[model samples]
Target: MRLYWVILCLVYSGSAVSDQKVYRWKDKNGNWVYSDVPKKGSEKVKLSTNMLTMPATDTSILTPNPATPTVTYQAKITAPSDQQTLRENSGSVYVNGLVTPRFANGFQVQLFLNGKATGPKQTTASFALRDVPRGEHKLQMKVFNDKGMLVAQSAVTTFFLHRASLLNR
Candidate 1:
């Protein structure tokens, strides 16, 4: 038993002493050099054995709560169905739109005629436009949140307008 214990201690001590030693010195080029081999002007360097450790992160805070679900908005133009023709002698047009599940407060709707904004943003989806020239035009609607961020957009609706011409009278 004593011989076995002595052999075990010797093995552990030999392993501990086998650690490589580091030496630091300046090379011929005047640059610092570090290596395990000793040189004539090299000095032994003592390195700290303490290791750096980091605490485990709590992933629960990074994950979103499951209770509140995200909402996606959908919008469509309800009036002036695509490719529809209208007869408006006074050059007036009425546009209407719908948003799925309704939008929250502070959200506004904007009308686009021929790819151009026709009027200021309004809370309702309805719009009354006047002096619309007679011809084909495209209309679209967009919904914006309180911060002016676009939430939803309707597909382009194409329509034609006709008005009485004095030459035809």
Candidate 2:
């Protein structure tokens, strides 16, 4: 029994040690090097042969539901974080907010500026505060589903940025 146990332990240890992964690639000058650390000028890497490849399976399990029911959420800037009032010569002002129902790959987000629909309505979206006459202004965001229907609207939040006009005070 003692001899059998020793052999089993050695076999397991050998397998584990052999499973370390290494990267492979050829350098820019067309010489090949196989070091665990990526060489200085290599652009692509091939993984080691000992790495396990998962057996191919039906792909449906990897797909997202197309008819997945849409979800909606309301985001607010919350109290002191919201109110900002600024000046006229500041060129363009930047307004920002955290968007909601973070999509798996952020594939269904949209943004609006000053009540005007801006852009083609994109996912992973952020909007710039632009072309306001200054003094005081409001910022808002609208997030939507892939189907173009309004799914969520952010609370109409306010903020301020001062150009030289207001800063001289």
Candidate 3:
């Protein structure tokens, strides 16, 4: 479903024209690099527009009945401990908690890191974040309705990510 937007956006922007040729090459670190303009000795790669073949969506999912009830809530973050230091080597953290009055119809919880929305819209009040960088970060949760309207929000929770230094190793 997410690929629909990406392909649609690319099609509208004309960034993925079928005739456009892309160059592929390996850098010093052995990572594959792709770009429109070819550097000296770079190989021209042919990419087909197979992404245009996307499945169609049913109309029933898009149209929602107007008789649904609206509910509001206030959620809070209960994990990672406010101002706590996490020492996970991989920099992963799990956040979970309860929402007051329970969740209403179509309500979803979203996690925000440093004021940026992260992860998928979920019906549960739990978030598993990966690769949190080293240093302090702020996390918050928000609940929204099926119409994408803001319903409930959690207080701002701050924490520090402690990573083992590799420079001195």
Candidate 4:
């Protein structure tokens, strides 16, 4: 394997160095061989001088512009208004929220129930909570930037969940 790489290097370098001579011959094992040194029964090989190259890239496009100001976001819970009561036998709740000045790209939303984060962060402003125990709960929505920094948060909205009891069935 080492010999194969050595021969390949010689062949490729020979093409780049036009002044160097390359020789090709078949060894006793019936395998074609390439080398910079000429051997008995070897023939001189001509390599093409043409090579492909790409222009240097402009790095200015990769850097962010410092003049653009960062946007400030405000989040609000639009559904399940504060102090509202929800009735669901399955304890499921649907939450909806909105962001002022439009939600930007690379931003995410997270829902907090009773001061604890629920479910994964999402790009949309809506969330579906399941299997919540019947009782009072606090809900809040927070917005995060691409860097995972907290950008905005909604005022805590208090609500009550009521579920049908089996004894009342």
Highest-scoring model, TM-score = 1
lDDT of candidate 4 at residue 105, scale 0 to 100:
90
> Which model, 2 or 4, shows the larger TM-score?
4
- Give lDDT tens digits, candidate 4, residues 42-75: 9999977766679999999899999999888899
Clashes of each: 0, 3, 0, 0
RMSD for each of the candidates: 11.3, 20.0, 23.7, 8.4
- TM match of model 3 to true structure: 0.56
Cα deviation at 97, candidate 3, in Å, is 2.8
Which runs in model 3 stand beyond 4 Å of their true positions? 1-72
List the candidates' TM-scores in order.
0.61, 0.44, 0.56, 0.59
Cα error, residue 74 of model 2, in Å, equals 3.4
Per-residue CA lDDT of model 3 for 120-145, tens digit only, reads: 88888888888989899999998887
lDDT of 2: 0.61
Candidate 2 residue-wise lDDT, 61-159, digit = tens: 788989998666664443324675655474576545565556444445555555666566666445554565645556666766556666677777666
Best by lDDT: 4
- Predict model 4's lDDT versus the native: 0.93
Candidate 1 C-alpha lDDT tens digits along 127-167: 99999999999999999999999999999999999999998
| Candidate 3 CA-lDDT value | 0.85
